[model samples]
Target: MTTKKTSIIKVALLSLLGLILIAGVYYAPLIQRLYFSLNIEDEASMPENLRTLHQYYSTHLIESSATPQPFPRQLQENVLPESFQSHGETIKTKAFFTDAKPTGLVIIKDGQIIYENYWRGLTESDTQFAFSVAKSITSVLVGMAIGDGLINDVNDSVTKYLPHFKGSAWDKATIANTLEMSSGVEFDEDYSRTDTDMRRFQMAYLFDKPMEDFLLSLKSNREPGISQGYNSMETQAAGFVIRSVIGERSLSNYMHEKLWQPLGAQDNAYWNVDGAGMEVAIGGLSMSLRDLAKIGQLYLQRGRWNGEQLIPESWVLESTTPSKPYQMPGRDNPLSEKPFGYGYLWWTPVDPNGREYYASGLYGQYLFVNEDKGIVIAMYNANNNFNSAPDWWKERYEDFFQAIAQKY
Candidate 1:
């Protein structure tokens, strides 16, 4: 080889070595975490991976081997064995079996489980991913934390509970602000943008480690409560704040004692955890179809279960009812939600009618409840068609349920 070529090779080797050294020193832990997580660019697993999310992550068990709440037998008059119509199309067991792509679907009416079905290799005993539907549960936990006096004031600075976030964008943030998605933290929740904050969050949470660190490093896009923003970090931050205040009472145990036991969940559940073993409250909850529906029924009854108020009635009302600028549609605020607005992590209709609300997630996980119609539907799906679906897509899915509601 020529002397010039030898010199060039030596220079290239040195530069690569320098890059390796820097990565090792600065991102050693993250590198190790990613090495255990995924492929190139440390990108999060795509929508396809959602089908087997429980298998992917190290999970913390939320067991319900303790007495599960029994469902009172009162099958609906217009059960699925008969028929239902959507947009003039007759939907039967076949669509739910092969077309609509549901993993499991449960329908409850007037406190009775009228109809239940499972498909896509799922059985009544199987547990499936609830994804962001878990955020609704996190919201419930926050309300409980408030009632428990662990968090005394929603208006107080969140940094008080989570001191590690001191001096950051979250320093002046309040619990209410985070709940409202108005924390103004610079988080890109746009599912379409691969480089957005949500993507980075997925990498840290699902693939890499130390999801909390990524949350703390965030800079403010604007002042707290000034503009609305949505991201998994808001829920994650809330989880941390609650965990810090609650002390050794871990989130998993708290859910079991306060929610699972009280609601009488049928079987055990699991929630995915991060590198530090904190519950991925943003997503990562797994449960059976019936237990998932029971949560909806709990809310439909305004947080009352078996004659007991598990969640405060006031909290349920506040969570279901859209507030402030959200009550008014055609909102032009950059951070304001279009089509429909949000209430306490729960999606609300544009009209602010307290009767309807939903908990939705990627790959077609949904919990749709129409209190006015006395209907609750929990659907688990693997919709290869629209896994990373946009908000408008979810809004349309509600219409499908509206049809079912009208028929019954």
Candidate 2:
């Protein structure tokens, strides 16, 4: 009787082991993300981690046109001012270089490069990480898709194109909702936390999971449009919708044909891709500072460059200006990524500087455009205080730009 019981136990254990193996294979990507969490905070390797991080990730090259666009040069010999006033203190030009940790700065006024500088082992040619600024790029593509009639309407439900989302809670969410970060999806944007939805996204990406599969696996934490949540996955969903609508066309290729080539980009760009081989449309673009400024110019020019209509003017205004219900969220009931008001993947500040918006990424990548002033400031940094810093740096950059604009 004892020998018979031992044999039965062995059989049960073997069956359980087989089941566990099957489950592991199915959940391998999630497991890998958990494994990758171990190195989330390890001190970055040399010259700056972004440069190396770019080397480690899966990437796709976005080619420039055969004839690159050239900005009319009126290079000012002395680009830096003696000092600029910030928060009641005088921050000298040295502070921007040493303290602010700027890697590149390109100032364009009246459609010409007035000042340009590169540092931190970076050059005008080096394709620095655009980070979240890539979201703005992705936003433009949505506009293009609309303009091209690939996407019928912004108000249409996301499930209209990506049928996979039909049974999901996002079925009712509009493309506009995702663009404005009002999707109400349960995705945490915090990169500092190992268990954050952002890290889970990275893990899924590393493990080669389809971006859509990862996005759809999420649950609806709140009713779509009932609240606003600033998460990368929202834009990821937007990109997925674009991919679904276009079908077989790569985002990078579409960008090359529509904007990169048309705008006459000076250099070829690279967009970070996922293991499933889709562009990381939320925040994975890397390009030279000059080309980034060109993107800014696309907006500043009211979507027209060199007299060619690249992005529609109406779309430009609609995207930057705050839309009601979805975009102009009430402060007392505030739920946003930042204190700043948002409009279609762009950040809008409460500054009394009148109406303005800019594209910002976690790594201090910024493309500031003062449309009224016809000024575009493209600044890139590898700041150590990313997401942990106070609002001072942003305010200081604004102060510097204001001072620079007045001088010019």
Candidate 3:
């Protein structure tokens, strides 16, 4: 009740308020990232979210080259077929595109842009998220490292480069096993489930937990190289090895030097980084559709660009080929998650000719290359209902791509 006590109480309250304001300012970025991660995707806000995701996450820029190699436009008339076979039924190709319009689609055949279209307000200049297609990008970086003699071989144990993984489940895993999705790491990749290991990994990224720590905590359910298992963590582990072998150089910097510049990328790319500034190698690359197609083009040329071997020819061949029986593509194949066979972070369709392979991501993002036909298709979609969509939807898209390739 005393005047002195009242003034003291007011001062104490003000001091606490000042501390709260300071804390809020200090942790504003983390709070914003958390807010973005926790909210459900509103269809109305999806476009802006895709465009501005870099603002919510830390990122490293992949600067474009001075001499950009833009694909020459030779737009085909009625390039897409009327229909394609899916489950022995003729599905209209136009209907497929109408039902789930992608943000952008770029079809390159014989080093020419034969077909290019945009929907959902996406432009050729606008960079879209690559999602888990980034795994294929990471694979190329690893191949480059091997070619440079920085990494001894694909068969080498991951721990050979990343000593931190020694004595962990990854100690026995080879770089090849990780690339083939055969690391046998016990990770529940079911996205529909909240309690799955994939969700735990996402939480770690959202909460600014070190990705390496989560990877280290994982244990193997089956022996390494036994069968194909889709594990994004395996790609992250390969990324870690890349960062380690390159010494003090950052992964994004190395990517720019080895990949972007060599591919003569027209636009600067963005690789999303975690709290500690480590690139999210499993997913999180964003670039223009043209530039993304350059990835396919590079591999299509067997890693040679501008008369230089950016990635070794042997590495390119090995990356696309399914060497193991368990990695073969089949609907009833017990070893793999999807019907597509696993390669070195690439998807091998069961083609008798051994011509085509692709880099795919969630929500319909794909970088497809038909080597024999000299076709490369780069598609970016905002298929929010992708998880719930019929399994044949993806297969249908594959058939359409094949039809285009055959026509070309």
User: lDDT per residue, candidate 3, 1-408, as tens digits?
Assistant: 699999999999999999999999988988998787665355656655666677788899989987798988888888878887767888787778766557889999889999999888788978887788999999999999999999999999998888878889897899999898788888888876799999988888887788988899999888988888778999999999899888787889998889888788999889998778889999988888999999899999999988999999999999888878878888898877778777899887644334898888777788999998899999987776676753455666677788888886
Model 2 CA lDDT for position 36:
42
Model 2 lDDT per residue over 281-397, tens place:
888888888888998888998899878888778888888887664465334445544545678888765452555678887657888888877888898887766556535566666
Clash list (residue pairs), candidate 1: 69-264
Ten consecutive residues with minimal summed lDDT in candidate 2? 38-47
Task: State each model's CA lDDT, in order.
Answer: 0.74, 0.77, 0.85
Single out the weakest 10-residue window by summed lDDT for candidate 1: 39-48
Estimated TM-score for each candidate: 0.82, 0.84, 0.95
Ranking by TM-score: 3, 2, 1
Write down the RMSD of all candidates, one decimal each: 6.5, 6.3, 1.7
Off by over 4 Å in 1: 1-51, 76-99, 206-208, 327-335, 351-354, 387-389
Q: Compared with the true structure, what per-residue lDDT tens digits does model 1 show for residues 377-408?
A: 88887665553555555654565666566666
The TM-score obtained by model 1 is 0.82
User: How far in Å is the alpha carbon of 392 misplaced in model 1?
Assistant: 3.2
lDDT of 2: 0.77
Least accurate 10 contiguous residues by lDDT in model 3: 39-48
| lDDT computed for candidate 1 | 0.74
Question: Which candidate ranks first by TM-score, i.e. highest?
Answer: 3
